[model samples]
Target chain A: MDSQITLSVNGTSRSLTVDSRTTLLDALRERLGVTEVKKGCDHGQCGSCTVLLDGRRELACLALAVARDGVEVVTADGLAHDGLHAVQQAFLDHDGYQCGYCTPGQVCSAVGMLEEVKDGHPSHVTTDLEADVELTDDEVRERMSGNLCRCGAYAGILAAVRQAAGA
Target chain B: MRALDYLRPESPAAAVAALVSNPNAKYLGGGTNLVDHLKLGIVSPDELVDISRLPLDDIQEYDDGGGPGLRVGANVRNSDLAAHPVVRSSFPLVARALLSGASGQIRNQATTAGNLLQRTRCVYFQDATTPCNKRVPGSGCSAREGYGRYNAILGASDACVATHPSDLAVALAALDATVVLLGPDGERRLPLAELHRLPGDLPNLDTTLGRSELITGIEIPFSPVAALSTYRKVRDRASYAFALVSVAAAVHLEHGAVRDVRIAWGGVAHKPWRAERAERALVGQQLEPDVIGAAVEEELENAASGDENAYKVTLVRNTTVHTLLQLAEGHR
Candidate 1:
């Protein structure tokens, strides 16, 4: 029940054979050694395994590795090739982590969330669905509710996202 | 997790054929809910037909000989469906319900058809060690005597008291949507209200779909009431939580009286509880608070609850009246 599949991980074409039951998070961490995506909850409740699949934020724990064959996966490690990405730099400047267990997911989620905002996706707190969405504190919190920081660093994370969004 | 074979069919017909060939095979959609169950060892499908990349991801307007309406493909993601221009303008309740259910990342991965087929979030069902009639037939239901905060209060059988968890299904029920399916025989359409089943003797059966049937798309007819409808969910938190009680309502007013209305309740039953009695009571009546309260009370006349979840009855009534009053104000 193992299939050989190729995924474009961080702009590199990497090929590996994965079992049908292997999750994308396990494949990226155990098989390919791309460990930027953390596995907090194998269930989809916690979003610590958030990754950008084809330039959109999705939980790797819920996706089967075989089903995502040939998909473009950009992890938190792939965000900065030469230098620190803007969101990562902002996280460091704002002190957005205590033990740094959820920082990778927070950064990846922030990066993808900004793209969604640019695409004008509305959140639960959005009052006007027709108008373009602005990245207010409520909007960011609602959009990032998937990733939980157990150390209670949400205030600093909120500040960092606002700084990165130029709001 | 158990080992399984994965198949990717190129077409919907081929997918149905693949399912018909294997009795223990399942059609995989976004992998949000089914994968979780797989990890929990709750289900052990021998094969998974990955239908996520099929050509069923378009959201277009169609005339199905009934009237002009929107035809949403089965593979359309929840976030994309909520943000679509036509859905936002014409069916705001659908968009609002979609946004209220899950987080941004989960919504990006969950599909329209998958959301409809999601299982109840009963704690006993998720835990394999516990006894759940929904997970194992003839087994005892743990939620009946355990912490029953999320148990159903309407249309519940003695065998099961779990509630449906989809906010989107509640809105679609109020909108009178139709579900399209493709099976080994041919194509068929089912009313959205009739798609889900009340837990009678068989708590294991969640829907009326055949074993080899696959959802192709959903047809949502156009209506003036649906265009201005809205959804309100009362959950444990402001966001990222399942509803304790939720209401989806659409009102059409004529000469300061109720001309027509549609109502549905979530987190109250095995399926989306369509408030037909309440809708009948409100027709030709003034949109006053007392009238709304009376109508909702009549609908909840048969509501039964235990001590742990008795608050849901009052909460559902208040939520419905508040939502209807807001819609009435908007219409004025």
Candidate 2:
């Protein structure tokens, strides 16, 4: 059965009726017309469907739209205030994308990664959990391991995260 | 994927009731694994009970005088459980294993219960058209004589050779954790070791959990030695890949002699292969390379392997020895 659900996406509240099987990625793309969140695998293996749920990184392909009703969702479109957000601007300035298929997911993942650092959440590469996480190249790589760049733009992506972190 | 009815139960009792009422229902947790199987047409559950909203996400300390312990709720996210200070400090092996299993995005969504119940990645079981005993009983196991690269090398039957793919469960087995389940009858607990069963005649049933049972939480007993434990996973990749062979080891030493040790392995068995023989060898012996190597050798004496994954035997021995040595060094 299809049920109506109201959600806050990119600071915009919208109500829609969707099937129970409709994933968050499908609702974002097919229903709300948020095409930025690409569905590369639609099985949570690929990070092309990454998004921010309540300010934390989550895979939209595996998340049910009905399950996440009323949760705050922020996509690449919501990151900008006046112009491109700092991370988006940094990606553009550093040439962090080649074909641009994984750019939105990369950008959103970077934003969530930065928040994780700010919140003192440690990564696998984090040697010392007592100290603040340094935004080093290795730390960034480990934090962004979920998001894959098939075009091999990892060097540019790493540089963008480094520059955005003011490291 | 087939159209399914979704129910979000407000309480644990209601969740159990909903599952008991519907025989063709599956409990939904993070959905990182279950959703993928659904899309692949591997499972067609008529109803999905969303238990994410249940009040079982807390990680509490259960210090009952023996030592400090942890009771992790079933709904606790993998990322949160790994990052919890109690787990990081008391049960480092559990934290490391959880971190080594999946990527950041999936970890943020995967739950403790779902990780324990996640199915294997056998290609034959994934392809519905093929014959897989796990997917459908009486369908002969294809991986047994086909591509057995990822198949089990320990406790595998001719009916099925698929391995259980959870790094967290391996660490829990080493810690002597207890699985708490809520059923229609009432609440009960089972040792984590007894939860998963080997694929014998019935390759379809992966766990000993009853049909109407729901995993509420996992309780890890407090142990001073578990503080010095660690997990070492050897995989095809550094992250976001399943293990080829992984070992979770915790050791305690006194006067250069081993006081206690617990070891469990993943990616090499139908369940988390607990190395009791190896632990017995090190219980009263010195922490020497030869001693550890001999113990590991004794543990793998009965391991049966196929032509493709015979290398896992060597990998298991090397990992077990290396982890024990590392833990021994920590004490020194």
TM per model?
A: 0.99, 0.97
lDDT at B260 for candidate 1?
91
Chain B TM-score (model 1 vs. true structure) = 0.99
Error in Å for residue B217 of model 2: 1.0
Instruction: Find the number of clashing residue pairs for candidate 2.
Output: 0
Model 1 lDDT per residue over B233-274, tens place: 999988889999999999989998999999999999999999
Q: Per-residue CA lDDT of candidate 2, range A34-114, in tens? A: 899999978777699999999888999999898898888999989999899999999999999999999999999999888
- B122-195 in candidate 2: lDDT tens per residue? 88988999999999999899998899889888899989998999999999999999999999999999999999
- Best candidate (score: TM-score): 1
Spell out the clash pairs found in candidate 2. Answer: none
User: What stretches of model 1 exceed 4 Å from their correct place?
Assistant: none
Candidate 2 wrongly placed segments (more than 4 Å): A129-131, B65-68
Give me the overall lDDT of model 1: 0.94
lDDT: worst 10-residue window of model 2 chain B: B61-70
User: lDDT by residue for model 1 over A1-167, one digit each (tens)?
Assistant: 99999999999999999989999999999999988899998898878999999999999999999999999999888999679999999999999989998888899999999999999998899988888998899998999899999999999999999999999
